[model samples]
Target: MKTFKLLSPFVLLLILIVSCSSVSEPESAVNELQVSNSLTEVEVDSIASTLSLFPNGTQFSIAFISDTAVSFYGAHRIDDDLKNTDNHDRVFEIGSISKVLTSTLLAHAIHDSIIREDQTVRSALDIEMAGDPEFTFLQLANHTSGLPRLPGGYTLNFLWNMNNPYKNFDAQELKTYLKDDLIMPRDPGETHRYSNLGAGLLGLFLSELENSSYENLLQKKIFEPMDMSRSTTDREVIKDYLVTGLTKRGSSAKNWDMADLAGAGGVLSTAEDLSRFIQANFNPDDPVLSLQRDSTFQVNDSMDIAMGWFILNRDSGDRWYWHNGGTGGYRSSVVMDPEQKTGVVVLSNISAGHSEADKIDRLSFDLMKMHFAN
Candidate 1:
C-alpha cells in the first residue's frame, strides 16, 4: 500500500522561514501565497474571498495566464482558518484532464508521421478479432469512439474501493477484457460518446507504437518540451510532493492509481507547470498544439470537441476551449481562448463528492469570461 507524506505543519514553517514573513494575515488569503502584479488588489481579494468558501483542508491553486500577463492565487483551509498557500509548485491530481494531454500525444504522433488520424484501432493493433471494432484515432481524441464510459463489469468495482479504483486493473487485464468482453455500442464517429475506455485504448496504442510506457512517452513527447517538469502520471515519482487528497468529510483520502488506465485520469501537476502549458497553446507555430486545437468535431451549435478540448462558442462570436475533470478526491477545470492568449486553471484537493466542488469549475469559467470582457 502507498503511504502519502503529510507536509502541513513542517512545510508551513519552512515556507514562513523562506518567505521571510513573521505571521499569517488573519482570516483571509493574504498569507504566504504570492499573487502577481498583473491583477489589481481588488481583483485579487475577490478571487481569494470566493475560494475561501470550501471545507477545511481544501487547497486550491489558480492562475490567469496569458501571453501578456500572468496572475495566480493559492489558498487552503486549516480548521476554521483560510491561509494563502504557495501558488508556484504544489502538486495535485488533475483527474481526467490527463485526457487532454493524452490527446496531445496523439497529435504528436501525427506530427511525427508515426500514425494518421484515420487509422483504425484494428489495423493499428494488428488484431484480427471478431466484431472488427472500427474506432479511429481521431474518434478517440474527441470522445466519439462509440466506446463505453468504462470497460464492462468494472464501473461498480468502486463499490469495493473508491479512492484507488484502478489499482488492480493493469495492461494485461485490459487486453484480456478487450479480447473477451469488449463490445462497440455504436459505429465509430457516429456520435459523441465520452469514454474513458476509448481514451485508455488510445494511450495504449500510442505507447505500443513507441515501445514505451505512457509516462515515458508523456515525458519525451509532451512534458519535457513543454517544461512541465513536475507533472507526471506515475504516482511513485511524485509521492514526496503529492498533496494528500481530502475526502468530503475533511479527512485524508488515499491517492488514485491508474494502472493501465493511467491515460483516463492519472497525472499530478502544479499551477505553475499547467500555466506553461496554456502559454504553449498561444503558439500557433507548434504543429502538435496547432493540430490538437484545430481539428474539431462539432457536437452542437454551442459546442465542439477538439482533439482533447471542448470548444464553447460564445454568443459574441468568440469561443473558449475548455475541459474539467474529477476523481475521488480532486477536481480540476481549465478554460482558455487561444485568440486572446489567455486562460484560467483551477486545481483543488477537495474530492468530487464535496458539496462545494462545483465552485472550481465555476471559478474557471467565470474568470475566463471576465478576462475576455475586460
Candidate 2:
C-alpha cells in the first residue's frame, strides 16, 4: 500500500496520454456511417453499466464520430443520488491530451521550417544534460528523451500538495531543475519512457523557437485554424467555462494549473471542441495532420510512439492513434482511427480511485470498437 501510494500519482500522470496508431491507413476501412444514427439501446446500456461501477459522482460526456456520422451520450452524474443526466456543454481539464496539441504545434513548427524533426535539445535550447547526451525534439515529444516521467523534485511537490502539484512550477524553476537536478533514467533515445517533463520541455522549446508562449502558439496555429472556440490554456478562461470537479469522496477538488508546463497538461476544452479537433484529424490537407501520425519511436510490436500520440499497431492491420489524460478531478481521452476517419472524445469531471484510468479507457475503447468492429 505504501508503494502503491507513491506510484499512484505517476499512474495518474501515465493515464493522461494513452494512445495507439498505425503507419498507413488500415487495409480495411470503416464504411462511412450516417451522422444522424442515434445511440442504440444496447449502446446506452453499455455506457450505463460501466458508469454503475464508479461511485465517485462522475459527470461525463462521450462523442463518437466517423467520416460521416456522429453520436453523443452523457451521464451528467454517476452517483445514484445525482442523476442530473443533462448534456450541457461543460468543459473539463483535458490533462495531458494537451500534449497532442503541443506536439501538433511541433508539427506546425516542422511544416513551417521553424524546427526540424530531429533537432537536438542542446542545439535548440543551448542547455546541458548530466552526461551531455544529445536529445532531439523528437525524443522529447516521443518520450525517449531519458527524462523521468516527472521532473526531479516533482515527487516532493506532489507530496507537499497533492491537490495542485504544478501550481508553483515556473519557467525559471524548470531551467534550474534541468541544469542541476535532471538525471537520465536511461540513455537518451534508448527506449520509450513516458515523460511529462519531456513533453513540457518540448512545448517550451517549441514556443521559444517561435518567440511566443505555448498557449499563444497553439491558439494561433491550432485552436483558431481548427475553430476550437472553447479550447484554451488560460486559467481565467478555464474558470469561466469550467465544470465543477468532484473527487471520489464527493468533495470539490481544485482545478490544475500547468503554469509554464502548459504544454504538458494545461488545456481545458469541451466535448464539442474536441470532436471538432478529432474531425480535423481526418482531413489529409491539414498541414500537421500527417505529422501527428509520423512515428517517432517504436515501443514494441503492440505499440509505437508518435509525436504526441500512441499508435497501437494491431495484428489485424488496424491502427488507432490515440491519447488519454487525467488530472486531480478530471479524466479525458481522445482516440482516432486515421484509416477509418473515425474517432472518440470523452471528458469527465470527477475522479479518484486507482481504476479511474481503466474505467475511462474501457469506455473509450468500447466506443471505438463499436465503430471499427461493427
Candidate 3:
C-alpha cells in the first residue's frame, strides 16, 4: 500500500509533477494522440495530456468511472513512433493487483459458508505443520500470515526464468514446499508484511475448498459473473487481445504464467473488464462485494487492508480503495472513491520494473484525487 499525508490537491499535484522522474525519450516519438470523442474537449484534453508522460512505445489506456459518466481514453505509440488510437479492451498483466482478486475469492468462500474467514491453512488443507504455524485465511489475504514473499528455494527455481518466474512452480511443487520446507518467521496476524507466497497459498486453499482450479474459480466467482470476458488467468485465452509487454530496458518481454501461483499475480485483464469489477465495489446491495471491501486489517492511520483492496484514508474522511500490479512486462493500477462514485484505472505495457513505473500509480491517484478536489 502507498502511504503519505494528504496535502492540498493543488500542492500535491504540483509536487507529483515536479518530483516525478520520466521515462527516457522514446525513439523519434511524435505528439500525435487520440482521445475519445465521447469526452468533452476539457475532459479529453485533461485526460489525454497524461499520455505524453509515458515512454516511447507505450500503449496507455485510461478509464475514468463516475456516477454521471464513464469515459475511456486510449493511445499507442505505433510503428512509426507516432501516437494513435488504442482500445480499452487490450489486456495487460496486472501483477500483484491479482492479490485483490485472490482476496475477493477468500471473501466469497466465507460468503458461501464454504469456510470461515478465520479457518487455518492446516485445517483447510488437513496438514500437520511445524513451528506451530497457525495462520488463518484472513491473515493470508491481508498479508499478515507471516509467510515469505516466495516459497523456499523459489529464487533458485525462478533464477533461470526471470521473465516467467512462477510458470514452473506448479501445484505439486507448492505442496511439496509447504510440507517439507514450510517456515514462519513472524507470528501469524501480528504484522503486515506483503507476501506473494501467502496470497498464492490462499488461492490454493480455495481450490481445496471448492474442488476446482483457481482459474476456474475466478471465472465462476468473478469474471464470468461480472462479464469480464477478456479477463482470465490463462494467458493463452487472452493472447489475441493481449498487449505485448516491454521490459524495463524497453525490449520485448514475456507474459508471466503463474501456474499454481495464479492467486498471487496471474490474472490478466483489460480496462473495460476491470471497470465492471470496480463498479461492483461501489454497489452497496452486493453482499460479497460489501464484505470484500470491509476493512480487515489496519496497517496504519493512513491505510487499511480490505479483502483485495487497500483503503487509503483521505483528509475528507472518504476513502480511496486501490491496488497496483506489475509483471515482467506490464504494469496496472486501479483506484476508486465510492463516496463520489469516481475512480481511475491505468493499464500500460511499460514494465513495472521500469524506472518510471510508479508513474502509472501516480497517474491513477492524481486522476482520482481530482474528483475529491471538487
lDDT (tens digit, per residue) of candidate 3 on 213-311 = 998999888887777888998888878998889887668888888888889999999887787677666556567777888899999999999887889
User: Can you rank all candidates by TM-score, best first?
Assistant: 1, 2, 3
Give the per-residue lDDT digits (tens) of candidate 1, residues 1-374. 22222233323311211111111112122123343325444444455555566567888787777564456667677655666677557889998889999998999888888888788877777754337778788899898988888887878886578867887778788888877888888888899989988887788778888889999998887687666878998777777888778887778888888888888888899877787777777766666787889845889999998998999998988778888888888888988888876788889888887887887888787767665457
After the best TM-score superposition of candidate 1, give how far the Cα of residue 207 lies from its true spot, in angstroms. Answer: 0.1
Give candidate 2 misplaced runs (Cα > 4 Å).
1-34, 78-88, 352-354
Residue 72 local lDDT, model 2: 60
**lDDT value, residue 66 of candidate 2:** 65
TM-score (C-alpha) between model 3 and the true structure: 0.85
RMSD (Å) per prediction:
8.6, 8.0, 10.4
The order by descending lDDT is: 1, 3, 2
Of candidates 3 and 2, the better by lDDT: 3
Single out the weakest 10-residue window by summed lDDT for candidate 3: 14-23
Candidate 2 lDDT by residue in tens digits, 1-374: 11111112112111111111211231222223345445554555556556655555666677777655556666744325324243435688889899998888888888888778888878877665566778888888899888898887577767677688787778888888877887878888898999888898888888777789988997888787656777898868656667877666667888888888888998889876787677667766555778767887889989998889999997779888989888888877789887778788878876643364567877888877774566
Q: Against the unseen true structure, what C-alpha lDDT does each candidate score?
A: 0.75, 0.73, 0.75
- TM for every model, in the order presented, reads 0.87, 0.87, 0.85
